[model samples]
Structures are given as structure tokens and as C-alpha cells.
Target: MSAAAAATARDALRAATDAIHARLHGLPALQALAEGRIGRAGYVALLRRLLGFHAAVEAALADAPSLGPSLIPWGIDIAQRRRAGLIEADLATLGAALGASAGPVPLAPLPALGTVPRALGCLYVTEGSTLGGRQLARALDGLLPPGEAGRRFLLGHGARHGAMWRACCAALEHCGAEPARRAEMLAAAEATFLAFEAWFAGAP
Candidate 1:
């Protein structure tokens, strides 16, 4: 595909998911957390939910090996991108800080990843989330105790965040080069966003 064609598919993805992406920002818990208005309990609850979401999504992506070809050449290492563990650790720290267990975090239900593009679509949502995580990490400065104990998930890949995101975007463009694959990716992306919104909204 030419540069112009690649740009168009990338734009198509952004255009398709833009509305739902905006809606995710409007989620009360997420909005409050982003604005630094959430208290300890609320913060913990938010992390618990996020842990569920990331844990499920990342696990599904891990099980899909076909994504390796499109991703590896772009420097996108799936293992390096796993964030559920960070979230789990953060929860443990928060729980320990309170002299209690974080308990079990339920996994958020996600759309089926039946194809490579569908799997990529799911990855797109989770990986792209790290960009916002950087800002959210800053918003959490005074919330967690000193050091990076409970905010590791938000801190994400730290300095590597930008590079990882760029690589992921490039991989996405490559996968979207084929129109059929692009449609599958877009549909799955939309489904992922909707599922996320529903889960975060307290729906089962």
C-alpha cells in the first residue's frame, strides 16, 4: 500500500472509534480519576475494575499467536506490553498499605477474537490506552504513597511509552492495509469499546 492509502486506513480507524473513545472519557469513575477527584476507596475500586479489563484483554491477546507476524517487525513485543501484572501489583500494594488483601478482581468480558485483525483490534484499544495512562499517572501523584508502589499500571511503559505506541500504530496501519482486514479490525475495535463502556458502567 502507498503512504496515502496507509494514512487513510489509520484515519478511518480513528474516525470510527472517536465517538466511543470520547464516551469512555466521560465515564464517571474514569473522569473523576483523571481529574484527581477520586478518594482512596474510589481509586482502589477503579484499579480493581481496570485490572479486570486489562487482565482479560491481555490474556486473550497472548493466546493469539498469529498477531506476532504483523507486530514483531514493528518492535511491538506482546510480552513486554503486558500490563495486567502491573495492575495486580498495584492492587496488592494498595491492599497491603491498608493491611488487607486486594481480594479477587473479576475479569471484564470482551468480544471474541476470532481473526488476526479482530485480535489486533483488541490490542489497539489496550495498547493505545497507555498514552492516556501517562497523564493519569501524573494525575495520581499525590494519591499513592511515596514511590511508584500503587501507580505502576498508570505509569505504564514509562519512557518507552511513546515508542511502543508509535510501533503499535504502525502495525495497525499495516494490518489495516487490506480493506477486508481493516473492516474486521474496525468492527472489533468498536465492539471492544462498547464492551468496555458497558462493563465500566456497571453492566455485567
Candidate 2:
């Protein structure tokens, strides 16, 4: 990639990251609830917002061509995994907080991949199943310019994922969750992003 294009990509990544952090800060009460530092209603509100914000992020990222292909799948995977892991973890934490264990609590499942809006598919190749890592990597390689811009974009995404994962961890930890469990969930989030990062790096 030319230096100018690389710079633009880097700037775009930074802008996205900033947007996400700003949203996180907007919900101080939710942050408190996730930490297990608030009331029942507050916790529920936080969870609701988290789910919505995650989807919104996906929708927004889907619009940026440089990020669209790589991020769409990453977003889908993270949303699904986070929905499942948080529900399991929340039930355990809430039960502990209330002094009782309970049956599995239900969560809103991720929107079926097909149900994802047509707008999101603008840059994606529609297919029956999820794209494998290798396929995604190849696609991104073709999209990303070779040079500093491509490298910076990959690094910026890695950094953004790290930041988002930390926010999730902070919320879970506040909820009286076990450290090990929190690590496991965060690891899954990291793995999803890292797969993309590796793909971008290995691209010709």
C-alpha cells in the first residue's frame, strides 16, 4: 500500500476504536452492574446495552470497505460467542450474588448469519456457510494494500480487539466471576481477532 493509503487505514482504525471506547464510557451504571457492583435491574440494563452496542458496532464497521470484510465475520463470531459465554457466566454470578444456584438462564441468540442485514453483505461474498480462516485471509489480502497501511490496519485491529476484550473482562470481573472463567471468555474473543490478524500478516 502507498504510504498515504496506509495512513488513512490507520486513522480509520483509530477512529473506530475511539468510538467504541466512548460508547463504553457512556454507561457508567452498566459498567458498575457488570462488575457485580449494582442492583438487579442495573445489571439487566447493562447486559441489554452491551448486546445492542455489539450489534451496532458490527453494523457500523460493516460500512467501511477497508474493514468490512475482515470485521463482519469477526463481529459475527464475537457476538455469538459473547452472547453464549456471558449468559453462562451471568447466571453463575447472579446466582452467587443472590446466594443460590439456578438453572440455565436463556439469552437472545445471535441473529442468524442469513438474517444479518443486506447492507452488511455489501462487501461480503454471500455463501451458505461461514468462511474459514484461510478463505477470509485470502480475501483480506486482496483488499488490503501491501505496505505500512496494511500492517498498521492489522495492528490497529489487534489493539482494538484487546481493548474491547478488556472492557468485557472488567464487566465480568465486577460481577463476582471466577478469574479462570473470565480468562476463558476473553481468550475466545482474542482468538477470533488474532485469527484475522494472522491472516492479514500471512497475506502476500
Candidate 3:
């Protein structure tokens, strides 16, 4: 396909996934997190959930040859985006604040990804969340204690956030997922979104 056609295909995929994406964005639990209403532990719980889910996703990508390509950018390795480590540090801080141990974090429920399309779908939701995370991190900056400990996960990819998200989009564009793959991707994205919303809903 030509450039225009590729852009059209990407747009179509976005349109297919848009409704579920909007719903996830509008979830009450996510709103509370972004609105900075949740305390430090509540924020840590959110990161723990993300860490679990991402651990699953990244592990799959690392083991699956096809899926790994879907995440590898032009030059970076998958570890660069596997941001659970950042979350763990923040969890340690939050745990200390609560006078509790930080090492044993509860993992979020895993989303199924037996196929590359499904994996990409999950990646779409996860990477897209980072875009919104930049904003959420700022909101949290004021609410959390004066340090990077709490918002490190939100500030993931660091100064390269915009570039990393662009890379994610480029990866999607290159997938050249036909209509069927797009549908599978959309389903995966929807399920992933639902899982995250539910996780946050049940958080303390």
C-alpha cells in the first residue's frame, strides 16, 4: 500500500478501537487516579497492578519472536519500555510511607495474548496509557510527596516519552494488520482496558 493507504489503514484501526479507548479513559477509577484523589498507597496499588500486567506482556513479547518485533523500536531494546522496575521503586516508597513492606506486590490479573495481534492490542492500550500518563504524572506531582519516588512509573520513558509513543505508533503502522488483525487487536485492546479499569476499581 502507498503512504496514504497506510495512513488510512491506521486511522481505521484507531476508529475501530476508539470507543473502548474512550470508555477506559472515562473510567471512574482512572479519573480518581488522575485527579489525584487517591492517597500514596492507592497510587502504589495502581502501579503494582500495572507492573504485573506489563510483566506478563513484556515476558510474552520477549519469548515470542513475532511479538518482540511489534515492540522493538528503531533502536531500543524491549527492556527500555518494560517499566515495571520503575513502578517497583515507587511502590517501595509508598510502602514505606504506609509502614509496610514493599517487596511483595500483588500482580494484576493477566490478559490473554496467545497471538501477535492480541499482544499488539494489549501493547496499544499500555503504550497509549503512557501518553495520558504524562498528564497524570503532573497532577500527581503536586499531590504526592516532594520527590520522584511516586510518579516514576507515570514518568516512564522519561524525557523520551513523546518519542517512545511515536515509536509505538510507528510499530502499529508497520504491523500492516489487515481488517481481521485489526479486529483482533481491537478486541485485545478492549479486554485490556476492561481489566485495568476493574483492577483500579477494586483497589483500596
Highest-scoring model, TM-score: 1
Off by over 4 Å in 3: 1-10, 63-66, 69-76, 96-105, 145-147, 201-204
Question: lDDT per prediction?
Answer: 0.79, 0.32, 0.67
Tens-place lDDT per residue, model 3, 1-204, is 332243543575566666666777666656778777866656665666677767666676676676556545433356677887777777777764323555555656656776766776677777877778878887786567765767887877888888877876765655545667666766777678777767756665
| lDDT of model 1, residue 50 | 83
Instruction: Report residue 196 deviation for candidate 1 (angstroms).
Output: 0.7
TM-score of 3: 0.76
Q: Which ten residues in a row have the lowest lDDT in candidate 2?
A: 122-131
**TM-score for candidate 2, residues paired by index:** 0.29
Error of 1 at 7 (Å): 3.9
Quick one: ranking by TM-score, best first?
1, 3, 2
Which regions in candidate 1 have their CA more than 4 angstroms from the true location? Answer: 1-6, 65-75, 96-104
* Candidate number that wins on TM-score, 2 or 3: 3
Q: How well is each residue in 1-204 modelled by candidate 1, as lDDT tens digits?
A: 432354565677777888999989999889998998888888888887787788888777766777655467655677888988887788778773323374555778889875778877887888878878878877877687666788898888878888878887887888888889898988888899998998898833
Per-model TM-score, in order, reads 0.86, 0.29, 0.76
Clashing pairs in 3: none
